[model samples]
Target: MRRCNQCIVERMDSPVPLIPQLAAHLVAAGGKRLRPLLTLAAAKLCGYPGTAEGGTRHVALAACVEFIHTATLLHDDVVDESQLRRGLASANAVFGNKASVLVGDFLFARAFQLMTADGSLRVLEILSRASATIAEGEVLQMATQNDLGTSVERYLEVIHGKTAALFEAACRVGAVVAERPQLEEDALAAYGTNLGMAFQLVDDALDYAADQAELGKTVGDDFREGKITLPVLTAYAAGKEEERLFWRRVIEENRQDENDLEQALDLIGSTGAIAATLDQASAYADRAARALAVFPDSPLRRLLADVASYTVSRGR
Candidate 1:
C-alpha cells in the first residue's frame, strides 16, 4: 500500500495539490485490506513463485485492488453524506465533498493505470468490468432508496454489484496472473463472490448493531440515509400495522426525528430482523466455504474459510 501511494503521487500533477492529499488520506487510514489479501492469497495458492531477489506481479495487482476499493469508499462517503470512516472523520468531512469526489475519480484513474501496466487483457477486462458493475450497483441502490417495495432479490443484486464484483475480480485476477488452470480460477471467483455477499450482509446488519465508536460510523447511518438493506426489509416485512406505519414515516416518508431511530431499532429487534439477516449471511458464508472444496487442503484454503466464518460473526 505504501508503494501504491507512491505510484499514486508520482502520477498526480493536477492543479489542485490536495487531490493527492485527499486521495491518500483514507488510504493512510488503515483498513482490513481483505480484498488485496484475497488477491495475494489466490496467487500464492495457485503457485505464483516469489523469491526475495525477484519481484512478484501480484503485489502490484493487489495494490490495484486496494485503490479500487478506496475509490468507492471516497465516493460512497460523499453520496451518503457520511461524517465518519474507520473511526475517524471521513474524507468528505475533512476535505469537503467536492474534493472527495474529485479525488475519488483520481484514484479510479490511478487504478486503471496500474491495470494497464500489468499488460494483461484478461486482468484489465475483469477489473474494468468490476468497476463498471460497482457504479451500476451504487446507482441501483440510489434508485431503490426508501422504496418499501424493493424486493429482496433486488437488494441482493445491489450488493453483488456494489461489493461482491470487486472481490470476484480480485480473486479472478489472482488466477489470471498466476497462470492457474481455469477450474481453479473459477473456484477462487466463487469463493470471492460468496464471501463478498456475506461481508456486505453483515455490514448492513452492523449499521444497526454497533455504536459509532464500535462501527466507525454512527449507528443507524443507513436509516438516516434511507437506504433499503436486508435488515430493514426483513423487519418491515414482518412488522405489524403500527410497526409498518413507523417504517413508512421514518423510511418511506423520510420524516425521521429524535427517538425515531431507537423506535426503529426496537421494531427491528422485535421482528428478529437482525437474526434473520445474519442467518442469510451465514448461508452465503456456507456457500463460500463450500466453494473452496475444489482446492487442495492448505492453510490458505482454511484461512479463506475462516474469513467467511469471521465475517458472519463480526457484527456480533
Candidate 2:
C-alpha cells in the first residue's frame, strides 16, 4: 500500500498547476483505499509475491484501481452535485465542476497508462470494461433517481454496475497479475462482487442511520437529492398512505426541507428500512465470505472474510 500510494501520486504529477492541485485535493483526503487494498489482498491470496521487487506489477495495477475509483468519485460528486467527500469539501465543490470533471479524466487517462504499461490484454479488458460499466451504472442511477417505481432487481443492477463492477475487476486483476488459473480468478471476482454489493447497501442504509461525523457527509444527502436507495425503497414500500405521501413529496417531488430529513429518518426507522437494508447487506457479506472458501484457510483469507463482515457493520 505504501508503494501503491506512491505510485498514485507519481502518476498524478503534471507541470499543470491546477491539474495536480485539484487531483490531490480529493486523493489527499484519505479514503479507505479499499479498492486498491482489495487488489493487493487478492494478488497475495492468489499466491503472487509481495508488492516488492518481483511483485511490483500488482502495485502499479493496484494504483490503477485507485485511480479508476478516484476518477469515479470525482465524476460522481459532480453528477450528484455533492458538497462533501470524506467529510471535506468535494473536488467539484472546491475546484468547480469543470476542473473536477477534467481532472477525473486525467485520472482515468493515468489509469489506462498504468494498464497499458502492465501490457496484459486480459487486465486491460477487465478494467476498461469495468470503467465503462461504472459510467453506465451512474447513468442507470440517474434514470432511477426520485422514481419510487424502481424495482429491487433494478437497484441491484445499478449497484452491480456502479459499485461492484470495479470491485470485481480489482480482484480479477489481482489473479490476472499473479497468473492464477481461471478458477482462482473467478473465485476472487465473486468475493469482490459480493463484498462491493454489501458495501454499497450498507452505505445507503448509513445515509439515514448514521451521524454526519460517522457518515463523512450530510446524513440525508441522498434524500435531499431525491436519490432513491434501498432504505427509501423499503420505507416507501412499507409506509402508510400519509407516510407514502411524505415520501412522494420529499423524494419524488423533490420538495424537501430541514425538518423533512428528520421526518425521513423517522419514517425509515419506523418502517425498519435501515434494519432491512443491513440484513440484506449481511446476506451479501456472507456470500462474500463463502466465495473465499475455495482458497486455503490462511491469515489473509480470514482477514478478507472479516472485511466482508465489517463492511456491513461499519457505523456501529
Query: Which candidate comes out best when scored by lDDT?
Result: 2
Best by TM-score: 2
The C-alpha lDDT values of all candidates are 0.88, 0.92
Model 1 clash pairs are none
Kindly report which residue stretches of model 2 are placed more than 4 angstroms away from their true locations once superposed.
Answer: none
RMSD after CA superposition, every candidate? 1.9, 0.9
Q: Which segments of model 1 are wrong by more than 4 Å? A: 1-16, 51-55
Q: Residue 253 error for model 2, in Å?
A: 1.4
lDDT of 1 by residue, 1-316 (tens): 4544455446544667797677567757768888988887888888886534364678788888888988899999999999989988899999899888888888788789889999999999999999999999999999999999999999999999999999999988888988988999999999999999999999999998877787888788999989999999999999888889999998899999999999989888888888999999999999999998988999988998999999999876
Worst 10 residues of 1 by lDDT: 1-10
Q: Write the per-residue lDDT of candidate 2 for residues 1-316, one digit (tens) a residue.
A: 9999988888999999999898678677889999999999999998899845577989999999999999999999998899989998988889899999899999999999999999999999999999999999999999999899999999999999999999999999999989999999999999999999999999999999998888888778898888879999999999999999999998888887779998998899899999999999999999999999889999999999999989988944
Question: Candidate 1's C-alpha lDDT?
Answer: 0.88
lDDT of 1 at 97: 91
